[model samples]
Target: MDRMPRWADVILIPLISLILAALLSALVILFIGESPIEAIKLMISGALGSTYGWGYTLYYATNFMFTGLAVSVAFHARMFNIGGEGQALLGGLGVAVVLVYIPWPHWTIALLAATASAAAFGAAWAALPAYLQARRGSHIVITTIMFNFIAAALLNWALVGPMKAPGQEPATVSFPEATNLPTLHDIFGIIGIDWSRAAPANVSLFVAIAACVAVWALIWRTRLGYEIRAFGYSEPAARYAGISPFKIIMVAMLISGGLAGCMAINNVQGEAERLVLNAAEGAGFIGIAVALMGRSHPLGVFLAALLFGFLYQGGAELALWMNIQRELIVVIQALVILFTGALDNMIRMPLEKIFLAARRKSPPPPGPDRKSTSAEAAE
Candidate 1:
């Protein structure tokens, strides 16, 4: 039996952790000669206030959703795919390859081609690392970390050498106008919603939502998901049940890389219209916190992604208007990650104890058929 109710374990723990994180953040802001309440107000107004703010917020959320789902999938197989950064970079390369090389007549076709290429390139990049881990017993954490640097180097060489536009900056030329994605405004305008015309938010937001639903189904409704979860729970038992460790590891990482790679569609195809260095920013690493806080669940990941998205957008506003140091935003994010991931037990253990004590104190329900028991004893 569980020490706490399912609701408490999933909902209460994260809620309390977030509250504690917020309190600690408030204190930090207070110490730094700023009104914590005002800061929060600004954050709300800046991130959720205008259509423009919503656009940026949702854009960041879209990236986080993809990367978070990627990490969550690998996590179910007990593998930490920290190479999302590299995979996303390769995915951008894939987008670039498709957009520059293809002769698609319409945006929809271009989008489809870019998606396939992005996923394939990302999966290819991850295959070697998965092979080493599954076959040679190398640690995935170390291998994936190393791959990040290698990916950076490769991208640098490609951009500065063969792929750079003639006498232009170290980026590919802008994608063909035909390949340009429809922004949120275009989609909403169809329904008369009238979103901001200049917002970078696009159809990719819907893609992120679809990805979330797909992941939920993949992790919970399928036989492959069962095998993955069973292996994660106990590898020895999984092997005894005829599950293949090599297959599980490889399949999990490949799916993870594909999901991570899809983030490039939002940034490169939807927003940037050209692949550039550091296009990923730090979304890949932020995904670690997202997965941790969300407990590797797609629904939780969606909400957690929105929270971080708010922080990113609001932090920019705080730094711009309030003269708050930009690094303070990093500090706040670190505190959230620290509490939700590292100090999780600090909140959970106490709640478990409370629930257990309450359960023990409650009287047992009345016995069934006490008269029958007495008659039987007498007999």
Candidate 2:
């Protein structure tokens, strides 16, 4: 039997962890001579108060959703693909290449082409590291980390040398006007709702939502997902069952990299309209925390991404209006990541014990033959 109920594992544990993180953050704010209550009010108001705030929050959530799903996929196969940063960069390059070189008649076709290009470029970048790990038995973590730097250098060279615009800027020229995506404001305006034009959230938000659904189906409703989870659970047993470890590693990493690359559609094609240096803005690394908090489930990943997005948009608000240092905001975010990810067991163990005790204390239900058993015993 399981130590705890599935619902507790999926929902209760994360909820408790988030509460603890919030309490710790409140303490930190108190120590810094700021009112935690006021700080929280500002966060809620600034990140969720108006359409503008929602726009930014959802925009950030979109990026996190893609990257979180990437980490979740690889993690199912027991592989830590930390090279999302590099993969996302390459994906941006792919987006730039597609949008800059090709002349598409419409935005929809351009969006589809850019997505494919991004996924392909991201997968290609990950292929080498996957090969090294699968064939040579090299550690995936170390290799993927190294590849991040290599990918950065390559992107830098590409931008500055070949793909650079006519000016001194180390970025490609702006994408064609026809390729520009419709913003949330535009979409909502059609439905008779006014949205903030300044907000970056766009059609990619829907794409992110679709990706979540696709991932859930892939991970829970597919044969390959079963093999990946089985391999992660026990590599030796998987091999005995005819599951190929090499295939699992390569396929998982490729999928992970492709998902990571897909983030470019949100930040690059949807928002920026041109790829720039550090375009990823550290969303790739943030994905690790998102995956950890979400428990590597697609639904969990979506919710966790939303939470992180709130923090991001709220943090910016805090800095602008509250005069709170950016570092303090980072500290708050770190504390959240710490409790939710690193100190997860601190919350989980207690919950397990509590549930177990409750289960033990509960009375057993009457059996179908209870009266007959009692009569027989009396006789």
Candidate 3:
């Protein structure tokens, strides 16, 4: 039996960690001669106060959801695919290629084509690293990291050369008007709800949510997921059980890369309407923290993505109105990541002890067939 209940492991530990991180963040703000309480109020109001705030927060969250799910998929197979950055970059290239080169009759068809292209490109980029790791015993982490730099260089060359718009800017031209996606504002307007037209959140948000559901079904409800988990648990045991490590590694990384690539649909095809330099905006790295804090679970990833999204939108607000430096915002984000990811045990261990003590202190339940004690009977 487990020392702590499943709910405690999933919810309570993370909650406590977040609280502790908040306390530390408050101390940091005080040291910097700012009111932490006021800062928090601004964050809450800025990130969740109005429909406009929610639009931005959800937009950022959509990106995190894809990348976080990518990390979670790879993590299930005991692999750390840090190449989400490169994968996403290539995915953007794919989106640009499909949108710029092809003529589409409608947005729906274009969206589907671009999504397929992005996933394919991302998976192709990840294939080599997966091969090296599975066959040549090369480390996945090093190869993936190196691939990020390679992908950046390749994207730079493409953008400045063949894919460049007819100007100095190293970005693709705006996608055809027919391919433009409907924003959340537009969609909501159809339902007779007022929403901010300036917000970037769009139809792609539903796609991200769908991806989460797909990943959940893939990881926990399929035979392949069983093999991946089996391989992750112990290679020797998995081998004994006739599971192929090479196949597991390749499939997991492909899915991971594909998910990472799908993020392009939101940022590139949905918001920017063109592929730009540094289009991913560091969302790939933020995914690691999300996956870690979420315990590699889809539901957890969704909530963690929202929290990080709030931080991002809220941080922008702080910089605008509070005169807080961007670096300080980064520091606050790092503290949250630190407590939730690196310092997880700091919260979990104590909780486990508390639950264990409580379990011991409680009286044992009566057996179905056993008679009650005299004191119980009298009562």
| Per-candidate clash tally | 0, 0, 0
Model 3 lDDT-worst window of ten: 370-379
RMSD of 3: 6.5
Off by over 4 Å in 3: 364-379
Question: Candidate 2: deviation at residue 96, Å?
Answer: 0.5
Q: Write one digit per residue (lDDT tens) for candidate 1, span 1-379.
A: 4576656766787788888878888898888899998999998999899888888889999999989988888888889889999999999999999998777799988988998888898888788999999999999999999998898899888888888887668898899999999998898889999787877888888888999999888877899987888888789999999999999999999999998899899999999999888888878877877777787888888998998888888988899888687667677668777887789889988898998889789954454233312111111
RMSD of each: 7.1, 7.0, 6.5
Report the C-alpha lDDT of model 3 over 1-379, residue by residue, as the tens digit.
4577656767777777777777887787788888988888998999899889999999999999999999888888889999998999999999999999999999999999999999999999899999999999999999999999999999999999989999889999999999999999999999999999988999999999999999888877899977877777678999999999999999999999999999999999999999999899888888887887787888888998999889888888888888676466567567767887678778878888998899899953454333322111110
**What would the TM-scores of all predictions be?**
0.93, 0.92, 0.93
TM-score: which is higher, 2 or 3? 3
Q: What are the runs in model 1 whose C-alpha is more than 4 Å off?
A: 364-379
Name the lDDT of candidate 3: 0.86
